[model samples]
Target: MHGTALSGWLLVAVCTATGAYCLLRLRSDCARARSSAGGEAVMGFGMAAMAVPAAFAEPPSWLLAGYAGVFAAAALRAGWLARARENGGGHHLHHVIGSLAMVYMALAMSAPGGHTAHEGHPGAAGGVPLVTGALLVYYVGYVLTTGARLLPAAVTPRGGGTLAWRARPELTLACRLSMGIAMLAMLLAL
Candidate 1:
């Protein structure tokens, strides 16, 4: 990522932790929950790997291509999931967007004159400006909307007894919100 080393490390930590939590959600009794968590875990870990600071170790082009390939497949799977009648599909739609965004970033970074070519150029990152701008807008809106949804849940009391963190809808919302924020940050860096 095009940022201070500390910020890069912070992104890594947040993404890694989020991925771990998603893995825990795999234990959920709900089949849909397990499926969603598995996809989310992939996203979280992928973001963590991509967020590694350029200053520390610039990833090879082949690795970036691998990322693009992985995310492309993920996008396809998410799209299929979104079309399934039994699934709520709304969240899967978001996963589709997120996976495509990851593919975009990976491809952009792997381009010949990508991130490396723009060193020391303020506000000048690799990738098509229009595409990056659109992603930025999408992630920004996603973060805002998700945060709004989480607000009421934060203040409201629930009648049910305690549930596992993995089963708590509010925590899931919060996790999604955090990932949206992280995506926004990453788009900015791009």
Candidate 2:
């Protein structure tokens, strides 16, 4: 019921900063994955960019514009990369899903008064808040799965365990943790 301007701006700032950090961390990981897996880093950057404007701007229109633009660009870029894959690899599916979820959350958040046909209806969807919650779930899952994939790569791998516990895991953890925090912010907005 409360939609304070300060809170809204704060939400945008937090999400943007965290998302930017994640993208930087992902850049390093993508460099390492380049020889083996080419596009995940770029795709991750695309996802990070999608959330940036939403996180920094107040009101849905400005945020949504950035969100829509980034999402569209990502979809196109992803499609082009997919076409070039010998194995038709879709490694960036996590980024794709995460980005889509962020855009969804942005849309719902930007909705006027958080009101829609579903608002206050018993059997209705509970409007924007419900959609935001669903998006949070998807974002969380995407972060978890991507984290799991990065974990093994980061481990030093000695006798089926990590050793030295090098930089990759640290960077990967940074990316995943930032993403988790961003998603939590979205949840708070609801």
**By TM-score, who's the top model here?**
1
> Model 1, 78: alpha-carbon shift in Å?
0.3
lDDT of 1 at 79: 95
**Which tens-of-lDDT digit does each residue in 1-190 have in candidate 2?**
1235565455445545544544444434334343212233333443344334333444446755676566656655555555555634354554455556555554554566432235465322123556666766776776777677676654454467543312345554555555555555545444
RMSD each, Å: 2.2, 6.5
- lDDT (Cα, tens digit) per residue for candidate 1, span 1-190: 6778898899999999988899989999889999899889999999999999989999999999999999999999999999985885988999999999999899877776567555666434558888988989888889999999898875433574678777877877777887888888788777
The residue ranges of model 1 lying beyond 4 angstroms of the native Cα positions read 119-124, 154-159
The candidate maximizing lDDT is 1
Estimate the TM-score of every prediction. Answer: 0.91, 0.52
| Shift in Å, residue 73, candidate 1 | 0.8
